[model samples]
Target: MASLSLRQVIKRYRTGKTELQVIHGVNAEIADGEFVVIVGPSGCGKSTLLRMVAGLEEISGGEIAIGPRVVNQLEPAERDIAMVFQNYALYPHMSVFDNMAYGLKIAKVPKDEIRTRVDKAAKILELGHLLERKPRELSGGQRQRVAMGRAIVRQPQIFLFDEPLSNLDAKLRAQTRLEIQKLHRELGITSLFVTHDQVEAMTLAQRMIVMNAGHMEQFGTPEEVYNRPATTFVASFIGSPPMNLLHHAPGNRPGQILGIRPEHLDVASDGWPVQVETVELLGAERLVHARLGDEALIVRLHEGEGAPAVGSTLTVRPRQDRLHAFDATTGQRL
Candidate 1:
């Protein structure tokens, strides 16, 4: 495995004299064997950035390097990277073993070495029993695993995953995520994963790049991004209920927005007075949706705590240490 670097990377599309820049200058350093995920909402250019790294998309400016070589001019095949696409892209007629062996075959690897490599990958992916089965015969998760196994056999210096779990059901997605984690642990290949899913980004990434409107908002561990978001967008986008940004929160300065998470606020005898609008029971916890001077906020209540009745006025206090402050105009952390 080798390190990957993106220095002032930019991508632009030109039509006649009209030029549309999609990816702004993005810079990042991914260490060897580190799994970094590029995550954002759709149209945020996360996938485009990953494609640039994969050599599928040409860079309009700046440099991309894999290890010691600058790969801006390199073809995808010459980048020493294996890509796992969203659609699986498996050959229906080819069995699992044959599908995984096709690249080596094209490279003219010896038959015994091909067998050894394919066998090893199959064992790692727990697809040994399905080696003879065609893609059509396998389940969606199994097909994805087969795709991963195909990448494993090549043993590329880096792995690029482009929303590979999008097609799976919720349960299968969770299962496949575990499988991917195990695969990464076993292979230790440098991986760049691109996805719009925050949960996937949080759980799968060693370090995550949070992108917004073609800009890199933040690049840090999940905990760092979640706990100490660099921008209001990062604060609001990374969580389940999202961070609450109060424009006119009590004790807030004129041009500042107060931010707090649902779980970080507690029902108290004295604090911000809010009229309960709704309550949602989520088994182990409850979400209290309330209105505070036309501003909405959610307070998380753990099990054993009574859910407040709708239309009732209750006071919720945000944990002092957990509060976040941002500039209202810039939406940037203070």
Candidate 2:
């Protein structure tokens, strides 16, 4: 395992005559044995940053270090980092055992050591039973596990995951996410995971780095990123229904753009007057869509409780201490 440090990292693509900057001076310090997630929308440069760290992409400026070595000019193989991609890049003809053994074989490790390493990784990934099966024979989850097993077998200094769970179905993704967390606990490798899914980032990451327009919006734990977002973008990106951000001027009155989370807002019997527009009953909770003047406010109430009828007026209020204040001009947290 290794600690990764990125200092003023940048990436640019030269088209015909235009120099497009994909990443702009990214800086992060990932400690050894830490699981950090890079999360942002498509074109936000999260994947670009991770690829740069993996030595798969060139860094236009600055430097990246894995442990004591500056790996900016190093080849991917020289960096001693194992990367798992979104597509399970398993060899079609190769059985799972051979696939896991390929890296050690290419590295010229002895045959017996390769067998020992492959056997260990397969057990860790619960792929021992499927080692003799080809890629086509395994289901999607098993294939994904094989991809991870291949990486784990090498026991590299750092692990890089680029949306590895995106290909799986919802249920499988959830199960595999737990497996990943457990694997990280057992292996204790420094891992940098890139994904746009907030749920995945929240569940898998010890810390999350939120990026926007090639710049880091925030870097902190999932709870810190969720509860105390540095900007409106972080606030909007981290939650399920997302934080309800109303556009209003800063003041103690109704002018302040009140940031209330859906879970925080309760459907009380008495509060400010608002018209209930719709009611959606989820398994354990009811989502009440209401209109606070022109702003759309959603309130969550207990399931099995009768919601107010459509067009029915009810009072709703935001908890004062729970309100997050952002600057009017820049949308930064105040």
TM per candidate comes to 0.99, 0.96
* Candidate 2: stretches off by over 4 Å: 249-256
lDDT of model number 1: 0.94
| lDDT for position 117 in model 1 | 99
Residues 31-144 of candidate 2 have per-residue lDDT tens digits of 999999999999899999999998889999999999999999999999999999999899999999998889889999999999999999989999999999999999999999
lDDT for model 2: 0.89
Backbone clashes under 3 angstroms, per model: 0, 2
Per-model lDDT: 0.94, 0.89
Write model 1 residue lDDT over 18-123, tens digit each, in one string. 9999999999999999999999999999999999998989999999999999999999999999999999999998999999999999989999999999999999
How much is 130 displaced in model 2, in angstroms? 0.9
Model 1 CA RMSD to the hidden true structure, in angstroms: 0.7
Tell me the deviation in Å of residue 220 in model 1.
0.2
